[model samples]
Target: MENSAGIVKPQYVTFRDDFSFESGRVISSVTCCYETYGKLSEDKSNAVLVCHALTGSAHAAGFHRADEQKPGWWDSMIGPGKTFDTNKYFVICSNFLGSCFGTTGPSSVDPSTGKRYGIRFPVASVKDMVKLQKRLIDHLGIEKLLAVAGGSMGGMQVLEWGATYPDMMKTLIPIATTHAITPMAIAFNSIARFSITKDPRWNKGDYYEGEFPVDGLAIARMAGHITYLSDPAFNDKFGRRYSAFEGFYDFNGFFEVENYLRYNGYKFTEVFDANTYLYVLKAMDIFDLSYGRGSLSDAVELIKADTLLISVSSDFLFPPYLTEEIYDIMKYQGKKAFWYNIQSNYGHDAFLLEFEELDRLIREFFADRGL
Candidate 1:
């Protein structure tokens, strides 16, 4: 099958000697895969690191020189004169350490046993991903970033930048995200994980030696996909529509919407590994900026960047209220901050699909700052 876009073979960098997760197992050498776009300015001030959402990879923009089939993940926003404007800024995106796309994870070979780590692989955390990203930036000779931006899981990393490396960025843009995940969010993820574990082939995450648990993973993806869209979106797109060109005994599929989700799950399984999904989701679940905070507001105060928080009005996954809270916290701390509630019916995925609004805002936001 052909890759979606801008997919580049990336270079890997090791972070810890034996990186482990909260699950208490240490694995040797966690590797991260990343890609870079444009050139670092003479002073290296034009660097912008774009993080991808859950299930996204390092391919942020530009087609690989030898492979046109795989383009960058954010090609819509990251080319020459695009919102990210690679012509003016050096854009970097990387797969987190525990991901499947060329990065070390459960699917990667265990150096000790010469077998896939599978469930034996150490768990990863959001902090670990951020720390490894900093190493990637340093390796590129970028002392600081013009901006750190992304949506969803990527936005979580952006928030971490302000909290963990506040002085490293000139500006921060976190879209469609929250300072900390909600219990509902945890419940959804827990259910998805349960779907995978309940599969007989999961075999305690040791399915590497047997058939892949595609059915379970696909069901999990189907369930989660529902949360990514708004009720209005579903009503408009599918509502009570039934399957086309098929009767009651039809085998083509169920409703058009069911077919849609099935397709989404099917295509996703082609390029994404189930084990990697388990690892990454676990990382996201453990993400909570309030861990060190007396309150969420206190957690926001830890950020040290000129920040811009954007949220989609219809996004239930990480609602606009979360963005408002972050903005309020920053303002309470007397920091330079801005926010926008972009109206969209597309819900959480709005930040990715509703590009015209996002692209315009990002370009204007940076241009006004002379970035």
Candidate 2:
């Protein structure tokens, strides 16, 4: 099945090995789902890894099937003549290790018990996810990636790629992400997790065989959606608009923003898994570039790739200050680093929404490098 852009369908690779988790647990086998665009060069030197954000899938560009309703998440920036131009680069995007999108996650079956892994799935870290992707790259016969780029949690993976396999990628682009998750970010994630666990349907993440925790998961998604947009953006877009329902003055159906959240929450529950959400959030919360290294500076000093850090000015969640900190450290360590702060009202999601600015920056950046 091909999309209008003629991008190929996603493919799967099952890695049979004792996959080790950062938390000292292991999974006997793992499967990675991925989609590739364009052709890999003869020397395998033209490959780019496009990492997806939280709730995103490996279908980064083009339609999944002829009748598909929506195009891939980053379709705007990743097709013929687009920013990442599939015509010139072999772009690969893979679902994260613990994502629900055809990857080995909590929803997958546990080979040992013949049941869904659920809460029993070992905790994973950003490093673990990068390690899995590294193996996938090797499986595809790519010696090194030309570039690795992403925003949000996907950006965390990009950073991990640079840190874990410093020589694996030639360039790194971490957008709207931090080297270490801030306390404020952790607090928000904690609230989301608590909301999920407190729901009766959660049943300690073992709700796979019964009614799923849709309510809790929806609520969590609602909370996260709010963080993705800035107050200014929200006001401009939603403001004090009232719902269209008759006598919509009640607490449940009054504000248009409230209804919008509810709609997104409902939509998320249909596509996302509760247990996978919990596990992935935990991974983001505990991520620290300096976990094993002595300090943030020390950790970044190990990066051999040229780095580009992009931050949204209105992003309160991952904040511009955090990305600035990373830039400072990289410059201090004499590493090749560049920083660009996008003046946008869309907050943390600006990287995904502000296509014109993003495309311009990316185009110029690559052109300067003769890509």
Candidate 1, poorest ten consecutive residues by summed lDDT: 1-10
Tens digits of per-residue lDDT, candidate 1, 1-371, equal 12222334566677668665445667767778888777778988899999888899987876667547656767888877778876788888988778888778789999899988887777777777787788788877888899999999999999988888888998999999987777888888888899888989888878877888888788878878987999988998899788766675677738889989999987887778888888888888888877766777777787887888899999888989989988887887899898999999999999888889988888778877888
Q: Which stretches of candidate 2 lie over 4 Å from their true place?
A: 1-5, 244-249
Q: What is the lDDT of candidate 2?
A: 0.89
lDDT for each residue of candidate 2 in 2-60, tens digit (9 for 90 to 100)? 22346469899999989999888988999999999888889999999989887888998
Model 2 RMSD to the real structure? 1.6
Off by over 4 Å in 1: 1-9, 15-26, 65-70, 244-253
Clash-forming residue pairs, model 2 = none
Error of 1 at 295 (Å): 2.7
